[model samples]
Target: MSVVTVRIPDTMDHALRAAAADAPSLNAYIVQAVRRQMTLDAARKLAAVDAQAALDLDGEGDAL
Candidate 1:
């Protein structure tokens, strides 16, 4: 597996540390959290794009 380095602000670093304290491994916790957030963000963006496309189609049909 490839590895990447990330630099976090002091506040976020502290927060991540606190959140990962209960986790078995800090790396695993960060990976899981990032993956979950990415999934949610992608889903939200997709929904917005779909909604906009539907609106555009409606407008086009109205013009026809």
Candidate 2:
């Protein structure tokens, strides 16, 4: 529920607005994208803090 200000290159801004056309708002699109990236990053890590099995970030074990 906080507002943030950021700066980006003009080309990137153009692309972002085009991509966000289907989203309810530019802010919502960015927020969703951030959440998805964080989820993928966490999924690639060593293990969950609750003692769950690792999800195979090291290019070895089979993922669940």
Point out the worst 10-residue segment of candidate 2 by lDDT: 46-55
Clashing pairs in 1: none
Per-residue lDDT of model 1, residues 1-64, tens digit only = 7798878888798888888998888888989898999999987876777554654455455542
Off by over 4 Å in 2: 1-3, 46-64
Clash pairs for candidate 2: none
lDDT of each: 0.79, 0.79
- Show the lowest summed lDDT stretch of 10 residues, model 1: 55-64
- The alpha-carbon deviation from the true structure for residue 28 of candidate 2, after best TM-score superposition, in angstroms, is 0.5
Task: Return the TM-score for each candidate structure.
Answer: 0.60, 0.63
RMSD after CA superposition, every candidate:
8.3, 7.7
Error of 2 at 57 (Å): 18
